[model samples]
Target chain A: MDFKLKIWRQKNRDDRGRFVDYEVKNVSPDASFLEMLDILNVDLVKRGEEPVAFDHDCREGICGSCGLVVNGRSHGPGRGIATCELRMRGFKGGETIVAEPWRAKSFPILKDLIVDRTALDRIIAAGGYISSKTGAVPEANSIQVPKPAAEEAMDAASCIGCGACVAACPNSSAMLFVAAKVSHLALLPQGKVERKERVLKMIEQMDKEGFGNCSNNYACEAECPKKISVTHIARLNREFILAEIS
Target chain B: MNKFTALYRSSVGKKIIMSLSGLFLCTFLVVHVVINLFLFKQDGGETYNRYSEFMSSNPFIRTIEIVLFAGLIAHVISGTLVWLKNRASRPVAYEMYQLKDNTTFTSRTPMLTASASLVGFFLVIHLRTFWVPNRFWETAPQSNYDLVAAAFSDPVYSLFYIVALVFLAFHLRHGFQSGFQTLGLSDKQYKWLIDSVAVIFWLFIPLMFAAMPAYFLWFK
Candidate 1:
């Protein structure tokens, strides 16, 4: 298969970026999207041209290091999978795929299709951790959690911290990402100790990071690589209210 | 900033205000629709005029009217602020984007709020025509029914009312469910119920309201 690619290219954060078209021939249908990019980069390097730059670490979807708005979708067309998981078979032989970095005020483009995502890390740093003093490894069964509560907590914990929710959202709201972290901790008994403070600080950080408000659009959930539910956002709202009242 | 002020300044806080005020306004719509339904009674508008008079004269209902106006103002202000902030959050626009899978027409269009805001202009026209004359101005008209009938009989005013009601319907379709979600009332257990009620409210109320102008313009 072959594809004509219109990929956003930039030298640095301050550089004015624009889309540049290139053609790739003889792509394997089984090759992942990132692997196809690897082939393109190799071809570019052999031709003594600057290779297209994109972020990817784990070819597996779990690391959340890889992302691209492939043909106008965050992490390509499929649901519940990252960009690295998208295969060339998803496109036809003569398709023209457009790729770009996450377009948000907070996520500045560092290079071609690579936006700085440290804003998300800053939000997490605000209150995403439980402050438990570590002395020894505690027994796993010692702090028995209810089945439902544990399940809900795990579900919320499924978020891989990818910025796809922001990339896909019209308003660039990070509510789903923040909500995932907030709800993951809020649902657990261990996390309930600082739930009020946690929600407050995390939300404050989220606002300070210049993310938009959630209006129940459900775009984040749809484009989420992890398929994180918007119900977590509801829980985050409940938690924020409880935090405010208390 | 103080915690209260800080909370109100946050995105989630603005959303809470929007939901609370929007839900308050929805209640007012239900009451308004019920009162206006009296227009359909073929009794020469006696029942409708009496009801309108009672609504104006009664102190309790009058006090609630003040709250209703406050709710309207809050909804408009918070909604605008939120919209502006959301726009600023995405300074760069996508060249090629498609939202067919994840979003509904109402959900995707940020202009729904603008449509609702346009209803504000219609509200001013409506109030000047009906509310002002009915409430304060004695020389304008003696009966509330006569005033409403006279206004609705005008093609221009009736057309505006019908158009505004259509926008209001689109606003309510998204606003109803959005209000529940923002208020944390959309739990998994009752999400279906909330969604169903939103669909009914958005569809039924606006159509019923539109029917009033249509009725007076043609049927009556």
Candidate 2:
């Protein structure tokens, strides 16, 4: 496959960015999207040009690092699939693909396609965990958490904190991300200990980080690579209410 | 803190005021419609005049009037704040928005139409005839029927009021459910039902109100 690419390029966080065009010829349809980008980067480096910088680790789609707004959809045209997992065969030959970083006030660009997603990590660090005692492991059967509750917690815990939700949301809201972390922890007996403080602290942290409010648009779920449910958001709302009331 | 500041401080704090104010306005609309329905009664003169006098003179109703005015101000302002926030968040406009794919027209149009109707020229006329005389001037104007009939007698006035009511219906359709959601009255099962009922009632009722004025102007 031969493809034309219009990719966003910025020298630094301070520089105003614009789309720069490139063409890659003789690309394999079986190659992943990132693999094609790798081919382009290799060609650029061979020609003594600065390579396009994008974050990626564990391209198996677990690390949640490789993400870009491809053709106005986050993580590319495929539903519930990351950019790393998206194969080049999805596109036709001689196609022009537009790629850009997630345009958001909170996720500032560090370089071309590389955004500082430390804000998401900060939200997690605020209170995305249970305060378990640092000691020898307790007997697993001691707590005896209900199977349904454990299953629900595991489901909510699947969030990889990719910031795709923020990218997809028209409001640029981080509600899904915040809600996922909150819901996962709030459902467990271990998490129930700090439920009140966790919700209050995390919400305060989220607000302090300059993320926007949820518009209930559900675009996040549509674009999420993990297909994380919006039920997490409802659970977060419930937690926020209970925290405030108690 | 002041009344406005007190209402703006917290999430629950803001929404509690919004719900109370919205519910009050909802009550006001129902009562207003009921009073207007009296005009359709056989003894239009006596019923309209007596209802008007009862509304004006009753001490509890007078207290409720003061609160209603406050509620209107609070609801509009808080709702506007939410609207502005929602608008600011979505700074980029789509090529075209299809409501069916995303949200209801009632959900999107209220803050928009309400803002327009609140500030528009016809609303000024509405205030001059209904609000200003009733509230500030302390004038015992003609019967409510006469006032409504006179306003609707002009085709332009009738059209404008009908348009405003259409907007109001759009406002109420979403307002009812949004109010319930914000007030934490929404549960998973009942939530969709509440939203559906809100859409039906507001859409139907406002059309009914508009029809009365439209009928009197065109036919009577």
Candidate 3:
């Protein structure tokens, strides 16, 4: 399949970026979006022209490395998958695909489709962990976690910190991402020890990073590659309230 | 004092204030709507004026008026501050974006907040026409329902009301569910229940209020 791609291009972090259009002929319909970009880069290299730059690691949806806003929808119009998982067949042949980096005050664009997502890492570093030292792996049953709570924790844990929630949010809010991290740890027995402080500290870090507040737009939930529920956000709010009051 | 300052200073803390004040104001809207319903009685202005009189005179109601104004001020200030911070979060706008693909009308439209600002303007006008004069400034500002009937007699006056009520409806549509979500009261399990209740606030309340103006203009 042939496709026209309008990709954001910047020489470096200092260069003002602009959309540069490129056409790839005779591309495989089943190639993943990143793989299609690989094909385009190969062509650009052969022609001695600069190639588009984007972040990708595993080429799978799980690494949270691949981030792109394809045709205005984060993660390329597909529900519950990242840009790397998007297939060329989803678009009609000869269609134009617009790809851009995540735009937020915290996640500054490095070049092309790459954004600095270290702000998310800082939020995790703030208090997104169980502080107790565990020298050995404890017995799973000894923790006494209920099945429902365990499942919910795992659900929240599925968030990959891809920055799509912030990208999709009209306000550029990282609330959903922070909510996922907060809920993931808050629901477990091991995490309950620092629940109050964890929420307070992580939220303070999130605010300090300058992400916007959630307006209940639910775009973050919708564009989430993991399809993390916004209910976790409500839990985050509840935890923050409990933490603040105490 | 440190904790108190932190509560209002943080983003999440400000939102907590916004939700509480917003929900409190929603309750006031309900009471106001119910009192307006008395206007539908065939006894003319008698029943409406009676409730209005009690609302203006009762010591409890009078005392709560201070709290009501406080809540309004908190809601407006926190909301505006939050909005300014949110705008700053996105310094560079997306060159090409379609939020409509992912979000619902009320959810996506920044217009919802704009509508709320218009509703705020209408609130000032409403108080000037009714509340302040009837209660404080005037020696005799025509009896409540009679004054309302007289105001609605003007086509432009009633039309302005209908327009403002439209904005109020749009504001409440997003406000009710958004408040619940912010307060951590709406979860996946009970989101439908909250949304269902929101229909009464967003739908029933504004429609009932709009009906008053329409009744005075067309039916009465």
Ranked by DockQ, the better of candidates 2 and 3 is 3
Query: Could you tell me every candidate's TM-score relative to the true structure?
Result: 0.98, 0.84, 0.98
Candidate 2, which segments miss by more than 4 Å at Cα? A28-31, A87-95, A134-140, B1-20, B42-49, B80-125, B172-175, B180-187
Q: Is the docking of candidate 2 incorrect, acceptable, medium or high quality?
A: acceptable
Mark the 10 consecutive residues where model 3 chain A has the least summed lDDT. Answer: A134-143
Among these predictions, the greatest lDDT belongs to 3
RMSD of each: 1.3, 3.9, 1.1
Q: Put down candidate 3 lDDT per residue, A206-231, tens digits, no spaces.
A: 99999999888799999999999999
Q: Write the per-residue lDDT of candidate 3 for residues B21-126, one digit (tens) a residue.
A: 9999999998999999999999978999999989999999999999999999999999899999998998988877889988777765477677877899999989
Native contacts matched by each model: 0.72, 0.08, 0.78
Go through the candidates in order and give each one's C-alpha lDDT.
0.89, 0.74, 0.90
DockQ of each: 0.77, 0.24, 0.81
Better of 1 and 3 by lDDT: 3
Question: For residues B1-220, could you state the per-residue lDDT of candidate 1 as single tens digits?
Answer: 7877877898899899889999998988888999999999999999998999899999999999999999989888888888888889988787677776778877765557667777889889989888888778867546888888888899998998998888888788888998988877788899889988887678999899899999999998
Say what the interface RMSD of candidate 1 is: 1.1
lDDT of 2 by residue, B136-159 (tens): 665556766677777788998788
TM-score per candidate for chain A alone: 0.98, 0.97, 0.98
